[model samples]
Target: MSVFNSSRLAGKTVLITGASAGIGAATAVLFARAGSNIVLAARRVDTLKAVAEHCTAAHKQSGVQAGGKFAVVQLDVADKKQVAGLFDQIPAELKDIDILVNNAGFVLGVEKIGDIAESDVEAMFAVNVLGLISVTQLLVRHFKAKNSGHVINLGSVAGREPYANGGIYCATKHAVKSFTGSLIRELVNTKIRVSEVQPGMVETEFSIVRFRGDKSAADKVYEGLQPLVAEDVAEEIVWVASRPPHVNIAEVFVMPVNQASAGISYREPKV
Candidate 1:
């Protein structure tokens, strides 16, 4: 038998943004294995479809009750039109989403604000901050009507403290932190739960995406020390989402054993 009774997760639906890769992808898999119907959305249709397929397989093998669902949507969260149309496209069976993971975020160019390209700054804000809020605005309506649901925003250690050359990205994450906090307060007195997960130095395609597929540049980041993997953060999200309805996990700061803070790390020399 699967770890969870199918009935426990039967009607629970989880919608994950940035589900094409990294923490988002890993979260989709974990939630599926635990029996939540999944809706995977990302700009990369090919990769997103792969993740959606994994969710279907994971749920099927994990004993999700009859009619439990899995779906994929080609979504560019930064696009107002796309975000606006997203929920409308969701299948009826998965309409009452139980969880929304605002995990679509990225960083581009490790350069000071002055040296940063205009496009990079705009991209970061569009996807990391406004994009998150846009999705939340739409979903909160559904959640509020029921007065029950969980919203998990993927923040970063940078959000807690700004780093050199990552000013714009950090600023955007800070916005996420602020937005999530305000949202929590705004939704107070309702059973709607809101949480943020701030992770430090997770070794995922994050670096690759940040550097635009420059593998060597990305590899240099963790050459000396072990960093947290996508799955590590995914486990934390699963724990947060699984908490009792009345117990809202407000925030989680996850870091690798070798990492003490956002910028502090103990790395082996020449490793």
Candidate 2:
């Protein structure tokens, strides 16, 4: 149950986006335990440091000889220039990333496509779609040069099954899913691998962001259900990246037992 006794990541470097909180943070820690050097990117420098500490502590406990180092970068994936600059600063040792997790994203208030604010739509695309694509392009170039790497893109069930009030968010994730398929096709003969993880409903800051800090509203989203936690999704990501290079799990969809699809889940009455 402690961080020590975990599998050694063994000489792999992983660069994760949106790692300041939620799934990104959880995945960073998991990779750290596997002994992978962690390069965390996020907008919050303080939060990034906290995450790095968790990774470092876990590394020490694991007795894996510190297979890799931990580094943090304040990055806003939404900006093209910032994303480019972040990649350029990859530490020499960690430059050859074994894995890249594109986990930066946000959700505005739910609304019909026609009722969605243009700003919300633009922001979502900027981070979810443009940002994810930009980071992948840069990493692909790196992987192509190195002749090996794994890319794990975070998507949502909403991407696969559109929801009434989730128009814009669904649209962005749908783009990600499509891009993952196309990009993998383009790299068919290369050593680089592309994959996407589509999660149904998980308890995290997602609904908080969607409701703009409406705790009551966010709580309701996960009420009466054992929703997926951040680590649950992160575990899948780490496992996919840990697989042999010869085997690339292209797509993985995770959901809570009570949930079957996007926004379709069994809910019990509050006791």
Candidate 3:
């Protein structure tokens, strides 16, 4: 087996959305360690700065040279005006992004169908579907001009299998899956590549956000199972990006061993 060489990522610039924390932040650090310049975009500028610092520290630890610069941008992808002006906000040096990680997304509540809140539905779709599309549209245009780029979207198991109490979120991910498929078909003849990484049972602030800051409730989501962590998914993302240009890793469905589906996980009983 040929050993994967991460050096290929050196000097490449990557733009990541929702990069304030979780998988986005982890991906930034990993890419930085690989000597890639990173543009971290999120609404929380302070948190983005912290992530940038972590990226710098990771690059230093890796001993890589001549790369690993970072820029933090305040972005709320849900806002169309902000998404439209994103590139202008990026540093000129990092404007030519080699990779776009569409990671800015979230879930609001777990209300079942008949009782689902309209506001929650709109909020989830705004960021997860529409916001993702807006960013990708802008980036794909740039990619076409350069004739090269990679769009890596953060999808979820819910995209493949819908679970009760997560209808809207699942629908949004399904839209993402569909959008990724369409993009792959559209870019088949181009050097530009499109990929989706669907992760399952990740133990992140995701659950806390889903539970609206109810830490105790969020904790229960992973009560007795070793769920995947941000690093796990981030490693997969970096690995996907490290592949040779001729190779396209179209889609990756990653889940913890204990997770079989969106709602089906083998969590051990409390002792």
User: Could you estimate the TM-score for every candidate?
Assistant: 0.95, 0.95, 0.98
Ranking by lDDT: 3, 1, 2
Tens digits of per-residue lDDT for model 3 on 1-271? 3133668899999999999989999999889988999999999999999999999999998888957789999999999999999988999999999999999999988888989888999999999999999999999999999999999999999999999989999999999999999999999999999999999988888999999999999999888899999999998999999999999999999999998888788989877
User: Can you write out model 2's per-residue Cα lDDT over 1-271, one digit (the tens) per residue?
Assistant: 5333235357788899999999999999888877889899989989999999998987787677756498888888888899788767777777778789999998999788788889999999999999999999888888999888889999989889998898889999999999999989999999888889999887888899999999999998888889999999998888788776778889999999999988678999867
Give stretches of model 2 more than 4 Å off. Answer: 1-8
**Candidate 1 lDDT over residue span 98-191, tens digit each:** 8999999999979886899999999999999999999999999989999999999999999999889799999999999999999999999899
lDDT of 1 at 130: 92
Q: Give the Å shift of residue 126 in candidate 1.
A: 0.3
**Displacement of the residue 51 alpha carbon in candidate 2, Å:** 0.4
Reference-based TM-score, model 3: 0.98
State the C-alpha lDDT per candidate.
0.88, 0.87, 0.93
TM-score (C-alpha) between model 1 and the true structure: 0.95
Q: After best superposition, candidate 2 residue 185: deviation in angstroms?
A: 0.6
Backbone clash tally for model 3?
A: 0
In candidate 2, what residue range of length 10 has the lowest lDDT sum? 1-10
